[model samples]
Target: MRNILIIGATRGLGHSLALQYAKKGMVVYATARYSTPQTPSHGIHWIANVDVSHEGAGRRIAAHWEEETKIDLVVISATYFASETFEDLHWDKEVAMYKTVAIGPVFLIQHLVHSGLLKKNSRIVLVGSENGSIGLRHESGGAGNYGGHGSKAALNMVGKLLSIDLKPKEIPVAIVHTGYLRKENKEGFFEHGGVVKPDEAATALREWLESFDMSKTGEFWAVRGPADIKTAEVVLGPLDTLPTPLQLPW
Candidate 1:
């Protein structure tokens, strides 16, 4: 049985991945800051009050995992989003978001890999967004609401470097950019085809992870696809394809 470790599994994609994996009889170790109280099942395990942003936090998690089993699939599914423009965005807040979306996962993965808690044929998946694609402009001032776009761009680089580092170990890494989830659409980024269900996104992620070829490492896939999102597009064209979502490495 594959052991999957999901970081930041409180809600949305993370929560859905945890629940679905547990239902499928896979061992799921799910961590979150806060989660709705629920009964534990045979396959579902929970670790609460895990503030991933804390220094040395990854080591703590690794230490905890040393007690039982090694993980086969590591999912860094935690993300933070904001809608402030460059002039209006706070530097402190942006840095914090960067840590949450970028550095936190880097540290966590570093620790996990170093702990030797990963088995052969292991896979690492980082959840990211299209906003992070470099120099890709949104025609209608599209995803520029806040720093979500820029932070994602930073994550792209992180994903690339991580892939390079992990490749030698035969551990394939993939970064997926899921469509804007329904719950996060309070701002109506969904007026265009942005209405994919949370469950759908999670299912896509699971499928991709299961079917991914190690040779495809460092690829960024758009979940819930119309296959519309393109990689290596220097210029993001008009928003004609309202929800042609993309994922960038980082």
Candidate 2:
């Protein structure tokens, strides 16, 4: 896409995606949490104080958009991971998690659509997680991290509803498990059971997105496929049986 807008572009996959798009001479609009957003290099126009966890986060983006041209591809990659055990939990963190991962997207998309910043052919990609899938939970059987997983689950629902709402406009919305990401500065894919580096996940997803369209709207997917998922074989099918850009169950 020529015009790329990436929310939560401070670090991890968002940062890498922004850079990749900018390097391709595409117009990139990225956001950071604080007023003084980092400008690592030229081409990426960073918006300030656009915390998704807060209300009206999309307004911040619109305010800084000098040219509110229709965005071709919009990737919302903001996620807050809060570890919670059966013995310990934080209510505030969970609320923030939901606001950031789930609730925020609703308003963000609404703003984009209402402001005429998204076209009928525009694509909206939400970064949800495989851990969010209730259908896959029976096989994985992991406990705790309620907020982390729950928020993503909520995001899946959000994406589904957004897809339906935008259907009349012919816009497409989809959620994806971006893969178990290692630290942004990490090297090769190692440890944490195929925890991939940010750039690797970004590259795989960018390539796969070329074919994504209305045919795949309202669906969930694993951009890099079942290779990095722990419960993929048991929950879905044999590793070899699954395709690389596999569509995931809700």
**Reference-based TM-score of each model:** 0.82, 0.94
Worst 10 residues of 1 by lDDT: 225-234
Write one digit per residue (lDDT tens) for candidate 2, span 26-86. Answer: 9999888876454466799888788888768877777777764688999999888888998
Tell me the tens digit of each residue's lDDT in model 1 across 2-98: 6888888877888888889988988888887665347554566777666666667577677666336678888887777766765576777777788
Candidate achieving the largest lDDT: 2
- Give candidate 2 misplaced runs (Cα > 4 Å): 36-39, 184-192
User: What global local distance difference test value does model 2 have?
Assistant: 0.87
- As for candidate 1, its clashing pairs are 83-145, 83-146, 84-146, 132-152, 132-153, 155-250, 156-249, 156-250, 159-250
